[model samples]
Target chain A: MPRFNAIFFKLALNSLKSRQGSVILTLLAIIVSVYVLIGVEQIRMQTKQNFNSTIAGTDLIVGARTGDINLLLYAVFHMGAATQNISWKTYQELTTLSSVEWAVPISLGDSHQGYRVTATTPDYFTHYHYAELQPLQFAAGQPFEDVYDVVLGSEVAHKLGYQLGDKLTLSHGLGATSFSVHKDKPFRISGLLQATGTPVDKSLYISLSAMEAIHIGWNNGANSNAAHSVIDTQSLTPKSVTAVMLGLKQKTAIFRFQRVVNEYRDEALLAILPGVTLAKLWQITSVMEQSLRLIAVLILISSLLGLVAMLLASIRERQHEIAVMRVMGASPWFIFSLIEIEVVIVTFVGYVFGLLGVAMSFELAKNIGLEHFSIHLSSNIFSIDQLIYLALILIAAMIAGLIPAVMAYKQALGVRLD
Target chain B: MKTSILIQNLKFSYSPQSPLILDIPSWHVEQGERLFLQGPSGCGKSSLLNLISGILPLTQGYLGVLGAQLDTLSGRQRDHFRAQRIGYVFQRFNLIPYLSALDNIRLACIFTDQQQDSKQVEDKACSLLISLGIEQSHWHKASHQLSVGQQQRVAIARAMIHQPQLLIVDEPTSSLDHQSRDAFMQLLLRQVESTPLTLLFVSHDHTLSSYFSRSQSMNEINDA
Candidate 1:
């Protein structure tokens, strides 16, 4: 039986080799569609993973009154400037709440090169956790100690080619091309953080007192050197900070803490649950995801149809071949199975090549996604969903090839063989 | 003499609504008989051959081949019977174009009930090719690369590879010249001398009738 099957396989292989041009064209169509189908799925999954792992181990993020998503974008992601800053007095009072175990005040709205510069106390390093409550580890030195000390995230340090003890100044605004540069007080790079595969990898960390001291000799986003003080790290205290991340001693007290923060008497602050806000963000972008899904499915269907059409066209040309095989005692089922074997070979090869193509592109684009977009695309591309898609593609190919196989079977059974 | 084929009250048409194309009342051929049947074009010769080879069902009649009642067998059984017992050769396009001559010959043994290893099958093919006067250099070349006479010889080799009991040749000499046709007929007759093979040769030209032991026109046999 094995030898018999081997002969049939040889026949199918030779038949495909005989019609090389059409076979290659069909293979190209299948490869491209597989690439697109698997590519879209990988990106969708990686993007969701990147979003989910941004911030963890924190109960609530308290920021000035704004939309929950907006607060999340500015406080956790540092994507945009806050509408209003929380007063230092209000933050101090919030940290004193009985349920609050730890608090980290972060002051945003500064830039170093193209990366965001976040100013916070040393407590930020201790309390911050991400990606399954993994603590941030230093690749070089310790966290910021003096007012002029600074730390760099992995991507920021790598892209800027900075090392320990290197001094770089910040800009007053968050644009890539900032007009107001703070070149007066250059901060030393005290430490570098290992890659956490999160937005934190694209940020520069500095002391909050350094943030206040940089603005001392400036007014109204302009540098007035005439009234500039020499240097004062002692009286440098931030009057307002962008947001505060809080961790409660008890997980059950989160809702009550969020209510207390939201209904605060002194300030109009809004507190948000990060996971709920992330779900809302997905809902807002679900339409784009659905459209991409539809496009991928359409391409898959058309390519499969192209494969079927190619087989159907070959059936007409193979009529003589079919007649010859029939005269040699080949049954109608043999003819049918020959075409099916060809389809299986093509689809399986096309699927493998498609996966290789995706992996190669991921290798080329890994650094760019990490450095620029702060998205860490992992190298492991296989998932349960992708395996399911492979099975679906194979079944679809077999079902599609059935049309031509049946045609060839009927032609073989036709009464014309001399 | 042992009967190789028997036909009685055989009736055939393409479909129930189509006109009858063949209506043979009775016909029989003995074992080891070299019979030459002649008929002009469009005289139902091909249809009669189809019926005899089990390619067509016997709508009404008793048709037997090699002692097997072909009319009682199912379609798949008929196919198996043809594969195991009968060898067919066409007039033109006799070989699969893509396969090499050796592969083409070996393909004939795939459907039969015989179990032969690859080495044995390949040796059989090589011996048959050598006997048919096909050069060793041409054995591995694609069937299309061979000349027309060479292809026909290869077709004969393929038809006789499995050592069938009945060999059906359909106008295979029409494309060959007189000398090659004489040589081919001589070779075909010599190849079957070792076994008691019943050979049925059909053609439109009657000049080749001298090569057979008996001759009959299709009009004398088919009563359509």
Candidate 2:
């Protein structure tokens, strides 16, 4: 630094020291706004990650003809009832296709306690994959093989106090007060799934044979099984299934397989590419995300404005100080740069506060967020997005500082030291 | 001869529309001369001091200080020239409020070329402060904490620290009592006498001019 600049820098520091309270308040406002921006952006990114992580390995989701997002919600997330179901024959035919490696048929529309009851096959334990192509791991026992055997996800078992060999009955539908129960063949807990942080954790799994046997004597959704003592397993078969998750042997065969599934002659069905559909889902909800971003930007603008207001208000009192440096032969540019330096100091401190706030918050909430929402937020301080935000803040601070800096220059050049 | 300041047919105003605030036909201060310029209030004494120091723009003038023509140089060049050779003491003793007395004095050399060895500058500053009746204990105190008389002495020490060839004193004793004003004048004249300096001390109090070699009123010299 030039010698005059060193002096002016010290002068600016002393000037700020004289008026520390207002500067501190402006800095606090900036810190809080930056904190909000970081929090909102981090959560948004991680939630999208968690959603995409839920169904990563599955190549296609096969469901009765519906919107892509609707199928995603009803089939993958258990969010809504399916409009229609595919016949068991259609599911079997899909398994025989040359592109298909395996297909897990999931039968829905039932609940055990409050958790969704899904009837799948033994192949589901081996073929079904969630985030990172991870196969389901058992916390206890193994996948169900008998008709009345059931497997509980970690969350369900933990919530309902179920252990291995514990017996639980299934309700006829998702209704809270279901009039029909499968009392003839209650299921014994055969396995417990390790926590996967997906919709799978909120559901119970059973064998497809158990589903067919439970509704053996039901006539058009009415339970008539009270007259029967036992059902013949050899004669029972599932009439329909809610959806099928398909994995292709070759990833390139997805487009052809999806086209064929959508144009099937026997069944009216839609095959959704999970990744593409998830992108569209994000696009539909981007309006809300944009609104949140707008709010964060507005807060930053207001805080920067507060900085401008404080500096502008102090310029009148600082004109004499500027004149003092001017009489000492300091240039107008020196005064201008000095005022800007003060702003940079304040803004840099605010940025430090923001970074630490976000870092400490993640450290505090990491485990809890993972356990509850499966949102694995990164604790790393500087992502590309974060760097962009910091750069934008620096530009804003410079702009804010430029106002008072220009005014101080003019005032110093205009005033008389005497 | 290389006179400290030379002015001929000088005129100045704030703007083109305003009347002239300063218009002088001729003026000159020779080297090693202690001249007193006495004028009443609003007689443009401060304006004249500002012109001689090149703080104001010279619109129509043949003005020179230490053989350098004033109007031929840009504003930045004039600032550099002022920092190099001229020392000005304002009417209010304008020391920065935030800095200590020593720091305020150091500011004069901070922009000048006389800043090679900081310890040499400190020793010279301390000797001046002691000779000007400022004790060693009060040299590091902020200017705001000092009395008006003490601040006036620090301002004088600051103006003299860089050892300028020309010293312009602009009514710096306006707030001092009679006893302190006489003592300040005595100390200032003694310091100027100790060196071959051209002194231009301006004030409305004509009684203070008795210590100088010569005296002149604003009406006698100012054409405007």
Highest-scoring model, DockQ: 1
The local distance difference test score of each candidate is: 0.88, 0.83
Residue-level lDDT for B26 in candidate 2: 90
Instruction: Score residue B132 of candidate 2 by CA lDDT.
Output: 91
Tens digits of per-residue lDDT for model 1 on A240-307?
A: 99999999999999998899889999999999988788778768878888899889989988998998
Stretches > 4 Å off in candidate 2: A1-8, A122-150, A153-167, A176-180, A183-185, A188-197, A227-237, A367-374, B100-143, B156-165, B178-198
I-RMSD for candidate 1: 1.9
Candidate 2, A1-418: lDDT as tens digits? 2364455566667777778899889989999988988888887887777777787788999999998999998787887889899999999999998889889999898888768889999888887787788998999999998888999988899878999999999998887577787777789999999888788888899988888888877778888646767678887688889899989999998999899999999989999998888788778878999999899989988998999899999989876666666666766776787788888878878988988899899889987876677566667756788778888898889998899989988886676645
What DockQ do you compute for every candidate structure? 0.54, 0.46
Interface RMSD of 2: 2.0
- The C-alpha TM-scores of every prediction are 0.90, 0.88
Q: TM-score of chain B, per candidate?
A: 0.97, 0.96
